[model samples]
Target: MFFLKIRSIGCAILLSICGQSAWAFHKDVYEPRVPNEILAQEQQVKSPHPVTPERIEAGRRVYFGVGFCVTCHSKDGTGVNLPGHPPRDFTDAKWQKLRTDGELMWVLKNGSPGTGMPIRVGTDITEEDGWNVIQFIRTFGGK
Candidate 1:
């Protein structure tokens, strides 16, 4: 009876692994896009700071410093680790092409669901800083 229970547990674990593998391989049907309201907000909401070289530099500082983005996204923004699906590679041409600055801002303001990224909106990150970080991310891989 004990052996049978062990076998059952092993089977359950195998099924769980298989399920997660299937999900990882499964292609997403829904394409991610920023809503019009969010896009409009980017334009309507004036940043206290301008997108100057200094602002970009400041944004870079935040990305590596207080923001702690490098912990996952990596110093180069090329992503790190591959065991459990690596973080998004900001260097990807296709990804850069598909995503907009507003979309990036939206992700910053509201963390990506099911991701390790924490909600940074009301946190230490301010709206202007968020926009600045977006500007910094834009320069990733020379995009």
Candidate 2:
């Protein structure tokens, strides 16, 4: 009886793992033009930010409140960690460098489809807010 119980438990665990859906490595799927936002594979779009202190501050407000970026990206934009998904390290200068303003805008508007990032569609969030968030993300380095 004990052996059977152990076997059944193991089978159940295996089934659950196999039955689960796959997690997206990249959050953006709406950027049809980019066609390469498969995070870790290759960047389809670019990141946008003016790298100014003022812009960063404004972005911080949107992120923490209106944008609700904190819920998943976390308070520091370091990204939230979970099973089957890797966390985004906002501090990575290399990653920041590769992103372009246009790409960032696309991500903001459409969001990464498969990832936890929300599309943020039809919201009052202005383009200025998006750019500001970029600035704030740059500050993630915390200089």
Candidate 3:
């Protein structure tokens, strides 16, 4: 009889801990909106630099090297789900289809605020390199 009571109490404690953690992950976090002007722009606006084999290769290097994209987005761009946040999967065909080159570049340059993505403007990647990275990410969905 005493063992049953102790077990019940332990179960209740475990349930409460799990419930708290679940709630934390679902909590609404405020993310700023991207400007409509930029979002509405055409493909040209997104990637001013022309895409070439060399550019894509350069971007690949950045992804694995300096950009450190593999750390979060993973080598295949399938992304890794952290404790409370899930990384964006670049390999999703539907998701990739909907996004424009400009949007991708914008995200790379400014980074997705309120998320794990950091602003690259002040980082080691230059504007040209950012464009190159965009070129590489486009290949994630297999054009």
Candidate maximizing TM-score? 3
Stretches > 4 Å off in candidate 3: 1-38, 42-44
lDDT of 1 by residue, 1-143 (tens): 99999999999889878765664556241335345555666534445566799889888988898887888889888977746435677777777776666666777777754445566656868877788887788788444
lDDT of 1 at 104: 69
Model 1 TM-score is 0.66
Instruction: List, in order, the clash count of every candidate structure.
Output: 0, 7, 1
Per residue, candidate 3 scores C-alpha lDDT tens digits across 31-93 of 222555655654446566788999999999999999888889898888877654566778877
Candidate with better TM-score, 1 vs 3: 3
Please give the lDDT score for candidate 3: 0.74
What's the alpha carbon RMSD for model 3? 10.2
Error of 2 at 10 (Å): 28
RMSD in angstroms between candidate 1 and the native structure over all alpha carbons: 6.6
